[model samples]
Target: MQRRRLGREWCWIVRGGQSGGAATPAPTEKVIGMSFPAADHGWLGAVIKNAEDEAKAEGLKYVITTAADPNKQTNDIEDLISKKVSAIVMLPIESAAMTPVAKKVKEAGIPLIVVDRELESDDFTALVKGDNTGIGTHAGKYLVDKLGGKGKIVEIIGVPSSVTTMRSDGFREAIKDHPDMQVIVSQSGDFQKEKSLNVMQNILQSQPQIDAVYTHDDEMALGVLQAIKEAKRTDIKVVTGAGGHKDVYKLIKDGDPLMQATFTYSPLMVKDAVKLAADIVGGKTPAEKVTMLEATPITKDNIDKFYDPNANY
Candidate 1:
């Protein structure tokens, strides 16, 4: 018997089988539900596409819901819960806003697999994410080496979440040892390109003689680069980005000194999250509760290894 909750009611679904050679048993049908932020950017678009492909490959009935904001995400999760999916995978829009809904999923006895930005509490059965801190730490190290550990840095951040917090913390921690290194100002780009372009424009107006720029996402980094080019400011020597974007790779391959490096934060992490949910439905327990992928630094020296023209973000 399979136990599932259907709209506040707990019921058992009976399975059919036979005694010795009585009849052939029918295959059990199970569905997996997925919820994620809408495809506002390239990385998220790739994540949504990858999840759909993976779910289909697993041969399971699946439904995917995307939300533009935290409130919509909460409603989507609630709807999925009401449907009593065998398992759920969610990439929350904002961690704090979705924490309560995550708890609800737990109370309803649904196996939850959290991807990317994590909830505030451990209300999930499994977590699959990238090494955000490593990206920041490595980016800081790269700047320290390039700039000789002393420079005026401007930081362009993403939305308010654990991802943003950890990356900021790690960068600060990395540059703490260098007394002369200074972060002049930090502003939120909200991980959007156009917004970041406007923000960078305002920043360029105020801060003169800026040495480098650190953007949380590659999309924002592209905007920052455009702003620098439009302003024709040659003082800024280095600009670093997170998340492996093909455009960034092309720039590096073509020897753009300013847009030199990016760290690997692949959107394909959602594939692992979906696979974990499938494993749970297959009656297998995850050996580890949290699986974190590594963050690798990419630069002109090794651009050939990662530069794929046909690759999706």
Candidate 2:
């Protein structure tokens, strides 16, 4: 039998079949539950797509749900638990608020794999996430070197989570050694294009002499670019996260003056978790605790290497 956390107060159970091969009759059509924050923006949209594709490819019966609100996410988990899936893959909307859900899944004896944003629990079976800190550190170092170790910079942070905290901390650590480099303005853009644009506009108005801007996501970076153009500011440079977007690649390929670089944090890692979960259910031993995916720095010189026109997001 397989059991997992459903949300906050429920447990999901999955009946197991005889172990060992594809000859084992496909494990009696086991169901896997996937819960993630709603696709309020580009990064999450890609995450959902990756999860669905991976589930289909692995031939697992799956139920997928999305919740942007923490309470709603808890409710969704309860519903999934009632339905009793074998395993659950979750990308939490709020870390602390999801702990009860993780505990419930553990109590039910289901495998719980937390993805992307982490929850506050050791009860989970495994975790899959990107190196947010590394992404930020790389961006910081690159900007520092490009500006000759000194400049006025602005930062647009993502939603409040451990992921954002690590990224911001990493960036700060990298640039802390450079006395000439300073972050004049830092604000939360909530990882949305409109909010990023508005924040950028406000920063421009307040600090007209800014030299560089670092946004946590590419969609927000695009908004920063638009704000810069609207204000007719020619002195600032912009960098962003998520290098997979077509527009980001175009900016890098064409050597756009405004957009200098981006960090690669793939949404495809969600797919990896699905595959790993399927393997474990099929009696294959997989990593027990966590899987960390590396992030790459995408610059004008090597942007073409990651470009995929056929990619949906």
lDDT of 2 by residue, 118-216 (tens): 887787888898888888899899988888999999999988787888889999999999999998888988888899999989988989698898888
Which residue pairs in candidate 1 have backbone atoms (N, alpha carbon, C) closer than 3 angstroms, thus clashing? none
In candidate 2, stretches whose alpha carbon ends up further than 4 angstroms from where it belongs are 1-29
TM-score for each of the candidates: 0.91, 0.88
Candidate 1: tens digits of C-alpha lDDT, residues 97-182: 99999999999999999999989999999999999999899999999999999999999999988899888988998999998889
* Winning model by TM-score: 1
Count of backbone clashes, every candidate in sequence: 0, 8
RMSD of each: 8.8, 7.5
Count of clashes in candidate 1: 0
Off by over 4 Å in 1: 1-28
